[model samples]
Target: MEKRKEILNELEELSPILFKIKAEGTDKNIVVPNGYFDSVENQFLDRRMQVENEIDIDIPTDYFDNIESAVFAKIKEREIEEESKTPKRKIINISRGRERVRLSFLPLLTKIAIAATLFFFFIKGTDYFKSNQSIEEIDYLASISKTEALNYIAANTHEFETEQLVGIEFTEEIKNVEEITSEELNSYLYENINELNEEDFSEIF
Candidate 1:
């Protein structure tokens, strides 16, 4: 410690002499007050020679040997503690910021399945109506004539009343047949054809 203070004092006192060495003519003359100039000049020359010759540059082994390892350990521990105290920044991955989510999509698939089921049922209903329509004139043999068959069916199938049955009257296609009721005609039509069972009569027209 004493040696460090002595070196500091010497550096402070000799700073001006070293600064003068860089002046224009100081290399030849070195102007200063009488006795102080010579003393400062000798110190400057001695320091300059020591630097030029590389004297006292090598570190002594005793410097490391005599040093307190505890002091160095404490200093290193303080440095590590200071580093630990500093706040760490969180890192964000910009490449993954816009990634799309991976989802199961089961609900969407269920809705599509339901809609397809409804559509299938609607198509089935349309086909059923088209195929089972009884009013269409597909069975031409059953109808005698267009206008006559309509008039005959309409007049015979209307409501009528007599002493025995209280319903519509009907006549047989055969000659001299007993009078029949509309309920019997309905039963006959229902038994003969499958489409007439749904009330879509096709025999007349």
Candidate 2:
């Protein structure tokens, strides 16, 4: 308690004005020195005037009014530019794809057509060569024997005419006669007696 009293005494000694104000009643009017508030009011007015004079920044009247419209116009122009670029990019891509497809397929189709044409010509040429071959050449190539051919001709002889069988140099004259023995001549005479003429009988006699 004594230490608390000593601290209070020290605070009272340090702030006598505070103690005096506390002793004065709240109802008492506080007094000011002569022209004290007037000096303070003059200082404030001077400071305000100096600040207003130092600040010389000015703005055009229409700047704020058109700022929103200018910003929106810029945004709209950017959108239109992007819209225009989109179709151009798509067109370029599609054209490139079509060109690639044509380049890839054209050569393949051409090669297939050429191959088909070559095959057709090869087959036709083979058939033409076979058709132009001679019958003798065909028979030789087929390994047919002469006897087989003669037998086939003989079997179909009715189809051939007498003129076609005989040569252009054939003659009706006899070239020679072979001598016959008496026994053979006698047998022939006896066997052909009915076919004999008077001239043949005269010669035989």
Candidate 3:
């Protein structure tokens, strides 16, 4: 008890303000607004509800529901487009009659056949009609029209090749014609002009 009293006296002499505060005693004097704690939860809820109510956005009807199907449909369409672009070529025979045709690259023989068909369809239509041939009356321009029974190919050329048809252009014919030099033509003519007379010319014509 004597040691305690000596310690207190030393503290008081060292700091007189601290000594007076200790002597007087003290209580917590912090002031808070009334109902501040009680209203905290209510204020937070009100702010959250206001934020929720204020958020207004528009979306199309059924948009979310149909999104998956719409995406699939677009994917399928793109797949079909990719698949349709193929390198394989399609060749259509005029005899078979296809919807789509790219005939520019047909073989010479195939082109000749197609040319013959076109010739029959276009040229002979007039001649056969002139000869009183009807659709029912004539057959495929008739294999039996000539006396000898259907000898398919004749040696006669100007009469045979579709290009040799009078004054008409065979636009589809792919035959190559070699250029005749003037010297060659002159030499041929000098040699054969006598032999190529009126009858020969007439026959050729």
Candidate with the greatest TM-score versus the true structure: 3
**Strongest candidate by lDDT:** 3
How would you encode candidate 3's per-residue C-alpha lDDT over 1-205 as one tens digit per residue?
5797787798799999988886777544657789899999999999999987786445456766764454334434533553466233333332222322123222222333333534444545434334542333113223233211111212222234332221122222222111222343335435656645564444222
Instruction: List TM-scores for all candidates, in order.
Output: 0.14, 0.18, 0.19
| Residue-by-residue lDDT tens digits, candidate 2, 7-53 | 65776899987766655754457678898987998889999999977
Minimal lDDT window, size 10, model 3: 146-155
Question: On TM-score, who's better, 1 or 2?
Answer: 2
Instruction: Write the residue-wise lDDT of candidate 1 on 121-193 in tens digits.
Output: 3445434333443433312323133343333323342221121011111111111111223344335445545
Off by over 4 Å in 1: 1-55, 58-61, 64-75, 92-205
Worst 10-residue lDDT window for candidate 1 reads 163-172
Report the CA-based lDDT of candidate 1 relative to the real structure: 0.36
**Model 3 residue 154 lDDT?**
22
The candidate 2 region of ten consecutive residues with least summed lDDT is 168-177
Question: lDDT of candidate 2?
Answer: 0.39
